[model samples]
Target: MNASDSPRPSALDWLVEAARVRDAEGLHRTLAPRRADDGVLNLASNDYLGLSTDPRVIAGAIEAVQTWGAGATASRLVTGTTALHAALERELAEFLGTASALVFSSGYLANVGVITALMGRGDLIVSDGGAHASLIDGCRLSRARVVVVDRGDHEAVRTALRERTEDRAMVVTDSVYSIDGAVAPVAELYAAAREHGALIVVDEAHALGVRGRGGRGVVDELGLSGAVDLIVTAVLSKSFGSQGGLVAGPTTLRDHLVDRARSFIFDTGLAPAAVGAARAALGVLRAEPDLCDRVRENARRLATACGAETPSAAVVSLIIGEPAAALEVARRCLADGVAVGCFRPPSVPPGTSRIRLTVRADLGAKELDRVAAVVTRARTAVAATDAVRR
Candidate 1:
C-alpha cells in the first residue's frame, strides 16, 4: 500500500482533536492584536506603572538599539553579555536589596533555571497550588518530589516541610497571584521554610511595580530581602515595562546559577533595549514612588466599580463563574471601547473564570468611571441573557 493511503493515524490528528476539545470546552484562544491608535481603554495589559510608552523609556530603548544593536547577538556565555546587562543587574540587586542578581531572557526561564539548578532529583519542592505556570513548570522539570499546597495555606507549607523526606527542599510561591490578585502570606511562609531549613523562592511578577516601597517588590516590603534562605524571581515585562526577567538573591546563589543554570548558559542574554528600558523604568519608579500608590488606588477604585474586594496589588478580579459568560462580558466591554482580561479554565480553576482588570498609574479618574460604567453594563447584560436562557 502507498504510504499516503495507509490507515495509520496522521501525526497531526492529535492536535486537531485537541483543538476540537478546546473549542467544545470554550477554552480556545486567539491573539487579538491592537492597532497603535486603537483608542481602547486598556485595562487588560500588565503595564501597572504605565511606563511602557514613557518618553524616558522610549529614549532608553532607542539609545540601546543605537549602541548595542537590536539583539543580544549570541548566548550570554559566548558574547551576549553587554555593559547594559551588567548595569541592569547591579541596579536591580541594589533596588531589591539583594547581594547580586542574574538576568535571563524571560521570567519563565529565570524561574525554571533557578528552580532546576537549586533542586534536583531526591530534593523536595513545596509549591503553592496557585503559583504561576513558570514556577509549576520549574517544579516539574526539577525531578524533585513536589507537594502543591493550597494557596495562602501557610500551615500546609509547614506540614509539607516537616514531613519532607528529602534532605534539600524548596518552597515556591507567587507574591501576588496573577488571577485574583491575592497576596501570598510571604512572611508566614518564610518563617516556616526557615524553621524547616528549606529555601524559599518567591515570584514577584505582579508585585514589583505595584507593591512595596518604590516598587522594590513584596520580599523587600516584608523585610525578607537579604534572607539567606530567600530567592526572588521577577519579570521586567510586567512592572518594568520591558522584556526580561531576573533572579535576585545572595552572591553565592548568583555565582552558582552562572555556573549551573542551563538557561543562563545557553539562552541569549536579554536584548540591550530591554535592559536599558527596564533600567529607565526602575529609575522612574524610584523617582516617582507615588506611582505605586497611584496604581493600587486605581485598582481599588476599579475593584469597587465591579464589587470585587479591594486588591492588594494592581489586579482586580470579578469572578464570572463560566468561561463563556466571562468571554461574553469581556467582549461586551471591548465593544464599548474598553479592553479587559477574560481569564478562563487553566488560567484559573473551573468555576472561577473571571474578568481580570489591571490598573495603571496613569489611568485617569474619568477613564475609570467609564470603565466602571462599561463593565457594569456588560455584566448586567450577560446576567440578563443568562437568566433568559435559564
Candidate 2:
C-alpha cells in the first residue's frame, strides 16, 4: 500500500487530543466513589425528601426482593411485570390524580418513548431551550419538526405552534429546570398548548416529589389534573428514593405507548424492589404531606445564606460564571467534609457553571448552617482567586 493509503494515526488517538482540550478548559469529569460512612455532608444528591434510607423504604425494597426475586428476569411484555408493578402504577396514577400511568425502567427511556411514540414524520414538537438532556435527546429521536423556545417563554412556544404546518404537535419541557432550580410556567404553557391544539409532555423528574400538595406535582398544584390534556413523566430514583420511571397521562396514551413506544416495549421491566419502594414512598408522601414544606424550607435556608433569594424547590444554584472557579469551589466544599454538585457545560450553558445544592427535608438547623457556611467560604475563595488573577 502507498504511504498515503496508511491511516493517519487512528480515531482512538483523536480522543487523547480531545481530553487535553477538556483538561485545559476544566471541563474534564471524574467519578469519585462515595463512602457512605465518610463524614461528608451530602448536598449533591436528589434525595429531596430524604426517604432513600428511611426504614420503611428499606423494608419495602427488602420485602419485594423476597416476593419477586432479584431482577425482573424478563421484559414487561413477557413475564417481567409482577403484581407490585401493577399496584405501583395504579396507586401512582390515583395519587397524582391522573387518568392512568405507565412504568419504565428509567426516566430517560420514558422521555424517549413519549417523543417517539407520539410524534413521528409530519408532526411538530415545541421544546424548552433549557430542557434536560433526556428531553433533548428524545426530541432528536422524533421525526417531528422540533422548535426550541427560550426557557418558559409561552409566547415563543405559542409562536412555534402557530407556525407549524403539521396538525399534531407536542410541547415538551421539564417542569423544573434541573441546573437553575427554577420552576417552569406550566399554566401558561398549558394554555398555549390548549389553544394550539397541541399535546403537552412535561418531565416532572425534579418536581414530582418536591412540589404541589404532598408532592403530587406542578400540574396538581396548578389544578390541571384531569382538566388539562397533558402527559407527565418522573424518575423514582430521586424523590421516591427508588430506581425507575413513570408516565402519567390518559388511558389511551398509556395503551398506545405500551404497543408503540420502543423503549417500553423492549426494555426490561422495572425491578421489583424499586416498584415496592416507590409505592411505599407515595403512601408516605400522602400521609406526611409536611415533607414537601420541609424540603422547600431547607432550600430557602441554603439559598438565603448563599445571598441568593429563596428558591422554590430543593435545588439552589450558586453560579460561578467560570468553569475553573466552579470546580475550585466544589473541590473546596468537598475538602471541608461537604459534597455539592459542580455543574459545568455542557450540563449548563457556557459561562453559567455553578455548584448546585439539593437540600434534604431531614437536614437539621445546625446542618443547614454548616452547609451555608461551607458554600459561603467556597464562593469567597473563588472571588479571591479571580482578584489575584486579575
Candidate 3:
C-alpha cells in the first residue's frame, strides 16, 4: 500500500482518543457551577483570609462600578490607568514595604511581564524546578539562558548564577510552593542572589494574605522588605479575594516593566471593580491582622488531623497516589459537605497525586471536623476500591 493511500485521523478523533486516555486515568476535568448561597463548607478555594464575600469588599466593588463604570477601557499606558489603580499600587507597595508596585491583569501576566521585561537572550534566569507555570513560560519567552535548580536549593541557585556566562542573572522562586505548600527558603536564596550579584524574584501568590505581618507576605516577615534589588509578584485573587496581580520592586524596575513588558504594555488594564475590591481588602487586612493567625491555626488543625507536616501556611496536601483515587476522594469530600482541591500530574509529580486543602480563616470546628472525617473515610473507601480492582 502506498503511504499516501493511508487515511489520517480527524482532529476531533485525535482529541477524543486523548480524552479517553485521561478519563481512563480519572484525570478528565469538567467545570461545575458553584453558587454563592450553596451553604457548602469550602476548603478548596484560595480565599485564605475569607474576605471574598465580606460586605465591605462587596461594597467597594459596587462603589468602583458606580464611579469608574466597570472596565478600565484600555491598556495602562493608554487610557486604562485610573486613580484607583494608582492608589492600590501605592498602598500595596507601602504594605509590602517595596519601593514601588505595578499592577497587571493577572498574576501570570505579572510574572511573564516582569521576567521578560527584565531579561533577554544574553541574560540568564535560574528558576526553581517546581516554579509555577507562569514563571516557567516567562523564562521560556524571555529568550534567556534558563537554568532550573531543585526547589529551595539555594546553593544550586548560587552556583548557577555564578557559573552563568550571561552578564545579568535572575533567580526566581515561590515564597510558598503552590502544590506541596512548602515555604521556600527565601532568605537563603536572597543571600545567594546577593553574593552572586543576581536579581531575585519571589512570587507571593500563595503566601500573601496568609503569612507575614498583617498578611504583607514572606518578604516582610523575613524583614527583607524595601530590599530594592528584590522583586516580588503577587496575585490579588487569592488572599485579597479579588482579581488582578502586582509586581512590586524599585521605581526603575516598575518603569522598565511599564515601558518594555509587552504583557503589560499591550493588554487591557484590570477592571475597576477588582481594583477597588483589592484596595478594600487591604483595609480589611490592616484592621484584622489576627485573621492571619486564625487561618494559620485552621491550617495547623487540618494538617494535624491529616497526619501531614505542620503547615507553613493555610494549604495542606493529602497525597492519594493515583489521579483516579485523588479525584474520588475530592468528590467524596464534596459529597460529605466539603469542597477540596484535587491535583494530578503534571500539576503534581506522578505517584504523588493528592488533594490540596486550603483551610480558610473562617472554617470553624464543625467544618474542620467534617473535612477530617471525610478525608479519612475517603482514604478507606479508595483502599477498598483498589483492593477490589486488584
Candidate 4:
C-alpha cells in the first residue's frame, strides 16, 4: 500500500489508549480545586500549622510584592538575590541551628540539585526504598552507582556504604516517610553513615513543622544539626505555609551547592513573596511553639479514629487495600464536609492504596471530633461493602 492509501497514524493515539487503561484500572485522576470560602474541613493539605491563611503571612507576602514586584527577576547567581532571600536563609539557618542554608525554587529541585551536584559516576548513593520521588529522581540523575536499602534499615545502609567500590558515598532518606508517616531511624542511620565515613542527607519535608522542639525538625530533635556529615532538607510549603525548599548544613556545603548544583544555578530564585511569607511563618512557629504540639495531638486523634498507628509527624494514614475502596472512602469523607487525601499506585505501591489525613494546628477539638466521626463512618461503610463483595 502507498503511504497516502493507508490510514494515517494518529500521533496522540497512545495517550488515548493509556487513558482507557488507567480508567479501567480505576486510576484516572481529575482536578478538583477547592473554592474560596468553601466550608470543607481540609484534612488533605500539607499546611500543618495552618499559617497559609495567617494574616501575618499574607501581609508579608503583600509587602514583598510591593517592594520586589511579583516574581524574582533572575536566578540566585544573577540578579535574583534579594535581601529578603538572604534574611530568610539566615533566619532558617538560625531556626534550625545550621551553619548556613541555601534556598531552592522547590524541595524537589533541592533534592535533585544536592544529589547530582555532590555525587557523580564515580561516587555511590545509598537511598532508602521509601525516599521521596524527588530524591529518587536525584539518585537516577546523579549518574552514581545507586543502591536502595529497605526503609529505615540502618544496618543495610551501613553495609551498602561499606561495600561501596567508590571512594565517596552518600546515604539519603526521608526523616519521616510521607505515605505511612513512619519516622526513619535517623539517629541510627546517621551513626551508621558516620562509621562508614559517608555523608547523610535527611529530607525533613514531613517532619520540619511537626517534629522537635518548636518545630525545629527531626535532625534538631536528635541533636544532629551540628553533625558535620549531616544535611537536612525541607519544603517551605508545609508547616511554613509558604513555597520553596532549603538545604541546611555547614557553610561549606552551601557554598559547594551554590557552585555545583545545576538546579540552583539555573532556576530562578524563589519568589520574593514566598521568601517573605516563609520568614513570617518561621516567626510564627518560633512564637507559638505549641503549634507543633497541637498538630501532633490532632494527628494522634485522627490516627485513633482511623485505627492507624500514631504518626511521628502530622500525617495519619489509613491503608484501605484497594484504590477504588480508598477513593470511595475519601469521597464519602468529603461529602460529609471533611476532605481527606487518597493515594493510589505510583504514589504508593500497588495494593497499598491509602487515605492520607493531615492535621492542622488551627483545627478545633469540636471540628476534629466531627472529622473523626465522618472518617470512621466512611471507613466502616467501605469495609462492610468490601466484605459483602468478598
Q: Which candidate would rank higher by lDDT, 3 or 4?
A: 4
Span of 10 residues, lowest total lDDT, candidate 3? 8-17
lDDT of 4: 0.92
Q: Write the per-residue lDDT of candidate 2 for residues 1-390, one digit (tens) a residue.
A: 999998798769889989999999999999899887999999999999999999998899999999999989899999988999999999988988888999999999999998899998899999998788888888899878889899999999999999889989989988888987899999999999999999998888999878988888888899987666798998998999899888998899999999999999899999888888988888788889989889998999888888986788789988898899999999999999899999999898899999999999989999999999998998898899899999
Residue pairs in clash, model 3:
none
lDDT of 1: 0.93
TM-score to native of every candidate shown: 0.98, 0.97, 0.96, 0.97
Clashing pairs in 2: none
lDDT of 3: 0.92
lDDT at position 190, candidate 2: 90
**lDDT by residue for model 1 (285-325), tens:** 98998899999999998888878898999998999889999
Clash pairs, model 1 backbone: none
lDDT of each: 0.93, 0.90, 0.92, 0.92
TM-score of candidate 4 relative to the true fold: 0.97
Q: Give the least accurate 10-residue stretch of model 4, judged by summed lDDT.
A: 301-310
